[model samples]
Target: MTTIGILGAGQLGKMLAEAAAELGFKTHVFAPDADPVAAAAATHFTQADYEDIKALQKFAASVDVITLEFENVPVAPLKKLATPIYPSPAALEISQHRVREKTLANSLGIETAPFAAVRSPEELRRAMETVGVPGILKTCTLGYDGKGQWKVATPADAPPLPPGDYIYEGFVQFDKEISVIVARGTGGEIQCFEPVENMHRNHILHTTTAPANISAEIAAKAIHTATTLANALEVAGLLAVEMFITRDGHVLMNEMAPRPHNSGHWTLDGCNVSQFEQAIRAVTGMKLIAPKRTAEKVVMTNLIGDEVNHLESWKKPGAHIHMYGKKESRPGRKMGHVTILSPRD
Candidate 1:
């Protein structure tokens, strides 16, 4: 059986492992420590620091193909691996830095919020002048789930700038936030899942409803934009594009994640081919499967922090629950998710 190596052993990796097993692929999960969630789902687990080159090489040698669950994996170490990595380190680099990501998006004629690179306090001040108040100051790298982000409502309200590069983006009055997941094969074929409307709580994803209540035209445009980005990056796996739909119906690109996304979790129960399966197929050079929805509608709600304790209460018809094998859950941490499939209301 072909063995697949995954770089991060998070819940996403766990899901990917499950999908791999369903497809008769042996999965080896590598992380700093043995992640029970991934280990339970995968065939093997390697516990070693990412900086340990020898360990990485050994892990790479054991797998037929390699992929990453997260983009923050060190590129230098990945380059040393003998096996090929899907989505490419270049794609990860672009997704790692906001400045590079937005710049590349703009180069592709994809609309993004007004943004300026801020390397120093003076530059931030200048960026404030350019982007204006009611903006967001974010680190160029390693920011997610509302971390490493500061809201700047006014010049005085702006927090003391942290060390390192940042991006100042003018706030956009968006009607709703949606995300499209596009998977590209090595042969340059692309399959885009239906766009999903997402709701956030305290800047963390709360719920995602597939087949977002939007006009067919807007959905088509969103899918096209996501497909264009995936093709431009020449990514082998999945590329998820988060976008903001303005009140006037214009879709503005927000961010891109070059892997299975939280929004696409609905596909697990609602679609014939889930995002995780598609990612594995892409990386392994297997035939790509079209993402066809098997349900009329699907709603996925994240179980964050204490939400996991209430899982037993959610037992109802048509609800599929997935719990990551995490021992402890801190505030703002994702514990699991529940997807409900139902006919259109």
Candidate 2:
């Protein structure tokens, strides 16, 4: 049996391990968390810091191919590994930094919110002039789920500059936020899931409606943007592209995650192939499967914070509930999700 190595033992890792097992592959998880949630599902677990070269080497030697559940994993250590890792370190590096990601998208002629790199107050001021006010100042690296982000409604709102590179991005007057999950094979073939509409509360994803209520033209454009980025980045795994549809119906790229995404959780119940399975298949050099929706419509609602407590209430016909097995529930923390498929009329 081929062993799949997974980095970052979070809920995403747990799902990946479960998916790999379903495909008759064993999974070995490596992470720094002493009691990682993913360890229980994986066949083997290695608790080590991301920067520990010796531990990473040992872990790499044990698995046939390596893949990551999240993009924040340190790229430097993974670069030294002899094992083949999907979505390459170069792609991971670009996804980690906002500046690099945005620059790459713009260079591809993909539309994105106006943005400028900010290193100092002076540069931030210039960025405000270039990107405009009503923008957001976000750390170039390590920012997610609204963390490491500061809203710049005006110049005076700029707080004491933090100690990292930042990118100031102009906000778009978007009508809806949507995301597409594209799986690319080692041979460069791309398969895309239908675009899904996302709703957020406090900058954390709250709900996703699959087969977004949009014209076929708009949906096609969204998928085009996602596949374009995945091909441009040479991504060999799943790439989830979050995009915004402006009031004028134009699609502007928002962000990209080179792994299974929270938005794609709907696939677990609504599609023939889940995003987790796609990630594993892509890294293992398997042919990609077109994500055919098994349901007419699917709505995935996140169980956030204490929301997981009501898991029992969500159990019903056409409803698939998934709990991440997290011990504690904190505000804005993703505990699990419930994917509900709408009955066809």
Candidate 3:
């Protein structure tokens, strides 16, 4: 059996392993976590730090191909791995840095919120002026789920800038936030899932509804933006593009994830082919198929932190519950999710 190596052992990795098993592939997960959540589902597991070059090399040699569940996996270590890794390290590099990712998108003629790079307090001041107030300052790399972000409400609200490369982006007044997950095959064939609407609480994803209530024109624009970035990056795995739709119907690119995204979790039970399955298929050079909705309407709610305790409550019909095997839940931690499908009213 071919062994697929995964670089992270998070919940996403667990789902990918489950998908791989369905296709007759064994999963070998490598991560430093002592109790990786993915170990429960993966066929094999390796506990090692991402910087452990020797371990990465051994893991690479053991698997037929390698892929990552998260974008923050160090690019330097990936370059040393001889095994072919899908989505490419270059793609990972760009996705790791907010500045680079947005710059590339702008170069591709994709619209993004006004942004400026900041490496110093002086630069921060200039960026705020250039991008305008009521903006957000985010670290250029290594931040997610609202971490490493600070909001600048006014000139007087500028806190002491943290010491790191940051990007200042003007706030966008949007009607709705949506995301599209696109999978590309080795032959350059692309399969895009229908755009989905996302709702956030405390800057963390709260719920996602499939087939966003937007005009067909806006939907087409969203898909085009996603596909354009995927093709430009030559991604062979899943590339999820998150965007903001202005009240006037303009689509502005938000950040992106070059792997199965949290927003795409609805696809697990609501679509003919889930994002996790598409991720594994893409890395393995399999055909990418168009995703068909299993229901007219689908809603996926995240079980954040202690919310997992209510798992039993979500067991009603049409509600697909998935709990990550996390031993403890802390504030802002994602414990699991429940995807519910129902007919449109």
> Best lDDT goes to which candidate?
2
Instruction: Please name the candidate that would achieve the greatest TM-score relative to the true structure.
Output: 2
Residue pairs of candidate 1 with colliding backbone atoms: none
Positional deviation of residue 155's Cα in model 2 after best superposition, in angstroms: 2.2
Please write out the lDDT profile of model 2 over residues 130-161, one tens digit for every residue. 87879999999888899988888777788897
Q: Against the true structure, what is each candidate's TM-score?
A: 0.97, 0.98, 0.97
Error of 1 at 22 (Å): 0.9
The predicted structure with the larger TM-score, 1 or 2, is: 2
- Stronger candidate by lDDT (1 vs 3): 3
lDDT of 2 at 307: 93
- Model 1 has a clash total of 0
- By the TM-score metric, which is better: model 2 or model 3? 2
Candidate 3 wrongly placed segments (more than 4 Å): none
Model 2 regions lying over 4 Å from their true place: none
- What is the alpha-carbon lDDT of model 2 when measured against the actual structure? 0.92
Q: Which is the better candidate, 1 or 2, if ranked by lDDT?
A: 2
Every model: Cα RMSD to truth: 1.4, 1.0, 1.2
How do the residues 1-345 of candidate 3 rate in per-residue lDDT, one tens digit apiece? 399999899999999999999999999999999988999999999999999999999999999999889889898988988899888999999988999999999999999999999888788778887788889888989999888888887655667765888998998988999999999987789999999999999999999999899999999999999999999999999999999999988899999989999999998899999999999989898887789998989999999999988778898989999889899999899999999999655
Candidate 1 residue 142 C-alpha distance from true site, Å: 1.0
Clashing pairs in 3: none
The residue-level lDDT of candidate 1 at 123 comes to: 85
